[model samples]
Target: MRSGRLSFSFTMLMIGIAFLYVPMLVLIGYSFNASPLVSVWGGFSVKWYGSLLHNRQLLDAALLSLEIALLSSTGAVILGLLAATALVRFRQFRGRLLLTGMINAPLVMPEIITGITQLLLFVSMAQMFGWPHRGLTTIVISHVVFCGAYAAVTIQSRLITVDRSLEEAARDLGSTPLRAFWDVTLPMIMPALASSWLLSFTLSLDDLVISSFVSGPSASTLPMVIYSKVKLGVTPEINALATLIIVAVGACVVFAGYTMRRAERQRDQEMQAAYRQPAG
Candidate 1:
């Protein structure tokens, strides 16, 4: 019966949600454990959070990770915007296919392969030029190159849906092409730009394999630190750190969603008001 099928589907949906969220819930629960050992359920305590604050190495690693995420996301967005503009607007240029393929290369390549290739490339450059030296700068460079590909893909998808006429109208009103793009096209794709930057930040923050290959011993990231700790064994401190990250990211997502909805509502109001106006 249709009713029976509907009931089964609802049960399956609930199962799917549980499958995805149960681990996160468990991790969150363990974050409050007073005991250091993750496996043992100790009474609730915020002791680990206090300890985490004074852990200099971990704090340094976290700060470095945040810096990389901010810088690399900014760099990736600029590079990606350029790539997206060229691909979408200058479709008939020579080597278009090659350029497009290169921009998308990271999406298809395995992390190990990408990491190794970048490592080798950096080594060759450093050997020849005596520069970069596989530290923070080198890590940022690798992240920019890798993250830019994703940014380009994200922006390009949004660009395809955008109306070219907006920019053209700006140009017709005596704006230069570049000015028109700055004033019109950029605003239209603001959502995509925000998305691209956020995604790039997440990718750079989450990266382990690529960062390991590119970063020096002195420039270990938060993920690198967590990974090393995990090798020894999970602890309440790590669980606490992870839970904090989850909370921070969730807060950011909520804020972004709210901003986007507000923008949409404002735009809708403006459009409706414009429609109500008498013809000039």
Candidate 2:
């Protein structure tokens, strides 16, 4: 009975993996087809990739997307770190639950609503302060708002897992609160910080709807470019671009996991060594 159950579970797991990977496999396969129509494979060719590289507009849009992702993710990490610290350290405060809920509300809210709200706010700000017209800055700001929520949640969970005694020990050893945080708490949460930053970056880079609503005519993102092209019709070029993005993101994920595992191993080794040392 146990063997039968294990086989069934294994089969189900394989089915789930196939379900997730089959579409991606199809996309990658079509990317190599020479035909303009993705459905029909004329022959294998690299022309689509070459064309993608030469498309100035697409390149510009990609650059803009990168810039926005970098700025928005960085801003989100900073804001999220502060919010997470506040949430964890100031647990006695009134409305803590309400504030936490507000911070995480974006995760559940509809993207269209968030987009519309950001659009209206940008318009209002521009009209009131005669601020710079909405474009990349506005899009970045909108992304940061949502991205920060995700980062905060990630960081907060990690913070809760950390031992409070570490910080207390640091403080008891004559470290100021700030020093204790930097020396003890921050180091402990470095992995969470790294993970949160990358998560925010990926989220911002992949965002389309909110960025579309907030961005002006001049600041088109990679997703916007892809969406416009997709509206006309699918092409091998798009498939090629999608495949490239998949490969790049996959590589990044693999590298991050490898680095994190290495760090954890080193940490474990250090702990072992310390335990083996003679006590003074």
Candidate 3:
């Protein structure tokens, strides 16, 4: 009976894995098609990737998306760190409940509604101040608002798991509060920071609905451009572009996982060594 259940679980896991990866495998395979028509494959070819270099619109859009992703992710990480620190470090504070609600609201809110509300807010700010012309600035702000929430959630969970005594011990050893945080607590949560930053970058890069609502006519993100092109019809070039993105994102995820695992192992070794010490 145990063997039968194990076999069933393994079969279900394999089926789930195939369900998720089969579409990506098909897309990657089609990316190498020699023919322009995505439906008909002449042969394996790298011409579409080469052709992407000359596509000015796609290139520009990609560049813009990267810039936005970088800026927004940085902003989100900074804000998220602050928010998570506030929530975790302070046991009781005025407006703490309100702050928590704001942070988690984006997690449950529909993207379309979030986009629409952000658009309205931006329009009002524009009409009132005339400072932020709806374009890159607005898109970055919108991305940061939502991305920061996810970043905070990631960091908060990590922060909660952290041993506060480590920081307190550092403080007890002639280290100032700021120094303790900088030297001890920060290193422990570095993995969370890295993960949150990567998550924010991916979210900002992939954002379409919020971006479309906030971005002006001039600023077009990669996803927006790809969406428009896909509406026309999927081509080999699009497939190649998508394949490149999947490969790039996959590489980043792998790198992040490796780095985090290494850090964790090192941290564990340090803890073991410290515990073995004779309390010097």
Candidate 4:
């Protein structure tokens, strides 16, 4: 009976993997198709990939999206570090609950609601104080709002788990509070910071609804462009574009995982070596 149950579990696991990956596999295969029609797969060809360079609209949108992602992710990291530090370092403070709720609200709140609320807020602000004209500026701000929340949550989880005594020890030395955090605590949470920044970058890059709401008529993100194209019909070019994105994203995730793993192994080795050392 145990053997039977194990086989069933294995079957379920395979089924789950197939369910998740089979569509992406099919999409990748179709990306090489010569025919424009998505349903009809012609002989394999790389023409569509080459054609992406000529598509000015798609290229422009992609560039805009990249710019927004980079800017928003950087801003989000700064905001996340500040929020995470404040929450972790200051145990008791006035409006702490409110600050916590604001930080977490984006995680729980629906994207549509967030987008709509931001749109309304932007319209109101534009009317009152002629500032932050809609376009790339608004989109980046909108992205940073939600992306910062995610970054904060990711960093906060790591921050809370870190030992406070290390920073205290540094403080006991000549190191100031800022210096202690920079020298001691910062290294410990470097992984979390990297992870949060990547997450924020991915989120900002992938955002559609929020970008749509905040972006002006002139500003279009890559997702917005792809979505518009998909509305017409999925073509070979779209498939190729998607395949490229998947490959790029997959490479990044793999690289990040490998880097983090190596760093962890090195840390473990150092700890083991330290433990083996003789006492003074």
For candidate 2, write residues 73-147 as lDDT tens digits: 999999889989989989678888887997899998998999999899889988999875778889888888899
Clash pairs (backbone) in predicted model 2? none
lDDT of 3 by residue, 95-139 (tens): 999889999999889999999999999899989999688899999
When summed lDDT is taken over every stretch of 10 residues in candidate 3, the lowest stretch is 35-44
TM-score of 4: 0.95
Which residue runs does candidate 4 get wrong by more than 4 Å? 1-6
Clashes of each: 0, 0, 0, 0
lDDT of every model, 2 decimals: 0.90, 0.89, 0.94, 0.92
| Runs with alpha carbons beyond 4 Å of true place in candidate 3 | none
Q: What is the C-alpha RMSD of each candidate to the true structure, in Å?
A: 1.8, 1.8, 1.2, 1.5
Error of 4 at 104 (Å): 2.0
TM-score of each: 0.93, 0.93, 0.97, 0.95
For candidate 3, the TM-score is 0.97
**Deviation in angstroms for 92 in model 3?**
1.2
Candidate structures ordered by lDDT, highest first: 3, 4, 1, 2
How many steric overlaps does candidate 3 have?
A: 0
The true-versus-predicted C-alpha distance at residue 7 of model 4, in Å, is: 4.0
